[model samples]
Target: NGKEIPYDPSALRKIREHPCYSENASHKFGRMHLAVAPDCNIQCNYCIRDFDCVNENRPGVCSSVLSPEEAIVLVREVMSKDSYVKVIGSDIFPISHPSGTIVKSKDSYIKVIGIAGPGDPLANDVTFETLRMLKEEFPVPLKCLSTNGLMLPEYIDLLDEYGVSNITVTCNAIDPAIGEKIYSYVEWEGEKLHGRKAAERLLAQQMKGIEMAVEHKMAVKINTVLIPGINDHHVVDVAKKMGEMGVYTFNIIPVIPLYKFADIIPPTLSDKKAMHDACAPFVRQMRHCERCRADAIGKLGKDVQEEIYRNRGSL
Candidate 1:
């Protein structure tokens, strides 16, 4: 919300430049990502490996799945040469998402962030363990996770416990009725769940996740994918809920027609613009989103990246 203070760049810098970065920088590629976890608990109609999660017009997912040992060796090799390794966890965690490497090198100084690749973080316990291990062993400058919000509550404590101060949760529909029309099945506990019941449960958990975040005083950012017929009508409500719940900003993403919904057409730039305008009254609207790839080599929102770079240069 506008009333909420903007994110403190100084605070973020302290977290991103921790020992994790040093270890990753010692690797050969300068940056490396590994996905030890492959299972996903939810089936989103728009998620396809080859398109942007927010908008499907770009290159597909990039990043490899490596065991913890492989990741450590990769990071060490890359950082040894470039000394700026970015250790990324894509859809994998420690417990549910096992890793061969749990401990970070004392010199590991990498920027570690988690992306919701083929699944949601809230639905996976391995992801939680990965986060916990990272926090315990090598606290970095930033620890981020992307999710769909279903298991958000179950992990709010973990986020706080792990010192994860920044988070992004994707909320396509605030209205459960609308969500049912967009999502095909709800995957939970290895079962295919469906109907309004699934939608309701998902939405409720997402809302609770937000509430729990607010209670913990962590910065919350909501990413809403705008689907034309199904969830386009509910963006503002989503924004309002985020604002009221004390979220720092609202990233209104354009729907990417991928996977099961690949045949569906993406919204036009003008349509997205109009929707952005409509939702501006409720939360901070991100105007220059890049619709980054799943395994984006760079940052997520350009603005935040710019801030990071600027801060880094000054340091």
Candidate 2:
């Protein structure tokens, strides 16, 4: 985006290097997404969180879980090489593993470290711990995080302490009636909520969380999963709301029909482009989104999703 960044010197630098946050930077900058979060609080109708498959590509799929300690080792290695390399286990290999080929780059295209989960990053304690350890060990060039915004209000302070400068929140709907249609249940505060009640709580938190994140001065981006008949009309409303809250960017993600939403077809390119154009007036729209896997590495790399989906038959 060409808009002015209101952040101080340190925060501004993080946004500049962040590929997802900055359109121009993406072509020259790479990012590394660590799939360490193990669980999620809410269950979406389209979501199927799976692990150990090593053959599926999507948001909720990963080869294996990593301990905070293990995640640190990978980050350190990526930094040393000044490039993108995927590392799995103590035995780091340059090849793509069965779980997925994890690779690191050795160039000036600096990498932004982030956690996008097979589960929600905030739902896992290890996420915070990983960021904490990273901050202490070295001067983190640009740390980012992607979450559902369910736990943002509660953990915004911790994010500040751990140095998460860029955050992406997935907000599907602002209305509970629409939300209930998208999500099955939301596990909040030790209670499993269903239907409208669940959607109500989830939307409330999402709105509040986005507001809080903006106030914290973190570069905020809103990701809305475009479900044709579901939230299609309401995507603009969500964007207008995020725009009011001072969000930096808006990403309209095309839904991959799965689980309960398997019957629905994904939006065509024209449909998606229409939605993007509609939402652009309210907030700056992301030019291109690979809608990457939780473990996908590089600058919005196209490597992971293609490999995993094509080889699922081998499993």
Which lDDT values do the candidates have, in the order given? 0.57, 0.74
Model 2: per-residue Cα lDDT over 1-315, one tens digit each: 899967463247666787777776776677766778878898888877663111113544444667889777756655665223334432233333555544443434445777887688999899988898889985557788888888989999999888888888999998899999998999988899999999999989888888888888888888888898999989999989888889988888888888888889989888989988998888888867776766665556534323432433222
lDDT of 1 at 273: 88
CA lDDT, candidate 1, residue 32: 21
Q: How do the residues 1-315 of candidate 1 rate in per-residue lDDT, one tens digit apiece?
A: 559887663254422332111222223111122343444566678765333334212435443444444433433443343233223332112122244653332223335444444345555566666666556654643565667777778778878888776667777787888888777777755567797878887888888988888687665677888777778778888888788887766776776667766676778899888887887888766655555433332323211222222333421
Q: What is the overall TM-score of model 1 with all chains considered together? A: 0.70
Give me the overall lDDT of model 2. 0.74
Lowest summed lDDT across 10 adjacent residues in model 1 is found at 23-32
The candidate that achieves the highest lDDT relative to the unseen native structure: 2
RMSD of 2: 6.7
Global Cα lDDT for candidate 1: 0.57
Enumerate clash totals for all models, in the order shown: 43, 11
